[model samples]
Target chain A: AQSVAQPEDQVNVAEGNPLTVKCTYSVSGNPYLFWYVQYPNRGLQFLLKYITGDNLVKGSYGFEAEFNKSQTSFHLKKPSALVSDSALYFCAVRDTDRGSTLGRLYFGRGTQLTVWP
Target chain B: DTAVSQTPKYLVTQMGNDKSIKCEQNLGHDTMYWYKQDSKKFLKIMFSYNNKELIINETVPNRFSPKSPDKAHLNLHINSLELGDSAVYFCASSQDRGQGANVLTFGAGSRLTVL
Candidate 1:
């Protein structure tokens, strides 16, 4: 079974400080990792995805994620945190095997980020 | 313009009743999806339709059926709703499905509450 795990339920950071939300996954084949953000009472917005390129992939709103194949992880990071950046973050993964038939993404439980002013 | 839109942004109904959520996308994408976000905020894929063909169905209850009238619209119908079904439902679409590179366009979402 393919699944995604967000180790932290909540992450707190001060404004202008660096922030990281950890994510690990277990899958049978190569993984296509993605990050999405959900604001209060809103739907999820796509942040970034790791396909088959550089380890570090940059995405919207100055967010970036690093895909570590060895560790089976894709951690989202930002150099500076803002209060508006605080929201629910989710990490998802999909199998990339040529024989893979299930193309749906498995989402993580989600991590709440609270950035203090 | 909203790329993706879902009707009944908020739906409040009693248990055992039936309701339907409508979705439409204007991006001209061929694939659309319906996802359920539980109370714990875990988003799960319920159904996926690509070009009017079912592609991914994740063991969802038969009570919940998805209808895709065209490549741009996918509606979710829930029969005999249960309290546990109360949650946020989201509709999304993508240009195509593959190595997960396609960016999904999502609607604002519909909050379904079963009393």
Candidate 2:
């Protein structure tokens, strides 16, 4: 079975400070990891994904995530936080071994981020 | 234009009533999915369709039925609404089933409130 875990329920950061939302996964095979953001009463917006290659993946809205194979973690990061960046973040994973799942993504309980000015 | 759109952005109905949420994608994707987000912000995939064929059906209740009229349209119909059924339903689509790495485009979401 494949699953994603977001360790934090809420993360608070001051404006201009770096921020991180932690995520880890469990998969039978290689994992395809993704980060998505959701604002108040809105659908999730794709942030970034890590399939293969570079350890660091850059995504929209000046956000990025580092994929650590050894740690089984893909944590969303931002160099400097902005008030607008406050939202709910979710981490999802797809197991490459599960071909029958067919584009099904297993998501974690979202982490709420609050960036204060 | 919205890449993915869902009708009835908000719905409030009494228990025992039946309701449907319609979704459409203009991105020319071959796979579409329905996901439910609970009040605790936990998201779970309910169903998926590839080229209008049911491909993935999670451990969801039989009362929640998903119909894909075409590759671009997927609708969710729920019978006998319950208080526990109140949640946000999201419609999403990806390039194709073969492209597992493709990211999904999601609809704004339909908030359902069952009284």
Candidate 3:
């Protein structure tokens, strides 16, 4: 079974400062990791994904995530945060091994990010 | 234009009443999914249809049934609405489920409140 864990429930950061949201995953085979952001009363929007490439992956809205295989983590980061960046973030994972369950994303609980000015 | 859209943005009804939520995707994708977001904002997949065929059906209640009339449309109908069924339902789609980089595009979501 594949699963994702977002250790933090809420993360508060000041605007124009750096921000980090942690995410970890467990998969049977190769992992396809993804990050999504959702504002209030809206659906989730895709941020970035890591399939099989460089460890560092850049995404929308000046956000980036580092895929650390050894640590089994993919933490989202931003050099500068904005007040509009406050939203609910989710980390998801999918197993590459195709047998019974393929292309199904197992999402974490979610992390609420609040960037204050 | 919206890539994925769902009807009935907000729904409020009694516990015994039944309701249906319609979803459609215009991205020409082959896969469509239904997800439920609870009060705490935990999103979970309920059903997925690929090319008008049932692909993934999670451990959902029998009262909830998903119908895919075609490749571009997937609608969810609840037989007997309960208070526990109150949540925000989302419709999502992807190009295909065979690849590794299949990212899901979601709709705006429909909020259901059962009294």
Candidate 4:
């Protein structure tokens, strides 16, 4: 089974500072990773995805994530964090070997990010 | 326009009652899915439908049945709702060609509260 792990429950960062949200995965085959953000009482919005990509993938709202094959990690990053960027972040993984599990994404426990102004 | 939408943004019902959450996607995507977000914010896929066919059915209870009427609509009906079922249910759609991974567009989510 494919699974994702987000180690931190919460992360605090100051405005204009760089921020990082850690994510790791365990999959039997090649992994397709994604990052999504959710505001209070709102549905999740897609940020970016890493599917056989060039490791570092950029996304909406000045966000980016680096897919590390050796580390089995895909960490979301931002050069400068904004107060509005504070939201719940989720890391999900999908196994390339579809088989019976067709287009099913295994999500992480989510991490709350707070950017102080 | 809302690409993906779910009816009854907030649902409050008593235990043992049955309720249904409706979802529709105007994105013309052939694949639709239902995901449950627990109180702890852990998300799990409950069911998936491709072209109105059940493609992925997770280890969900029989009480929770997902019905896809057409290629764009998928509804979830839960019988004998329990307090543990109180959580936000999200409806998402994607264009999966059975070749590679595709991005999913999610609805605003329906919050279910079983008292």
Q: Give stretches of model 1 more than 4 Å off.
A: A98-102, B97-101
Model 4 chain A weakest lDDT span, ten residues long? A95-104
Residue A40 lDDT, candidate 3, scale 0-100: 93
Ranking by DockQ: 4, 2, 1, 3
| Model 4 per-residue lDDT tens digits across residues B26-114 | 98888999999989988999999999999889899999999998999999999999999999999999886653247788999999999
- What TM-score is obtained for chain B in each of the predicted models? 0.95, 0.95, 0.95, 0.95
lDDT string, candidate 2, A14-116, tens digits: 9999999999999998888999999998899999999889999999999999999999999999999999999999999985785644657989999999999
Interface RMSD of each: 2.4, 2.1, 2.1, 1.9
**lDDT of each prediction vs. the true structure?**
0.91, 0.92, 0.93, 0.92
TM-scores, each model vs. reference: 0.95, 0.96, 0.96, 0.96
Cα lDDT tens digits, model 3, B6-103, are 99999999998889999999989888999999999999999999889998899999899999999999999998899999999999998864552378
lDDT of 3 by residue, A1-117 (tens): 889999999999999999999999999888889999999999999999998889999999999999999999999999999999999999999766784443688899999999999
- Residue pairs with backbone atoms closer than 3 Å in model 3 (clashes): none
Q: What share of the true interface contacts does candidate 1 keep?
A: 0.68
**What is the docking quality class of candidate 2?**
medium
lDDT of 2 by residue, B1-115 (tens): 9999999999999999999999999988988999999989899999999999998899999999999989999999999999999999999999854543368889999999999
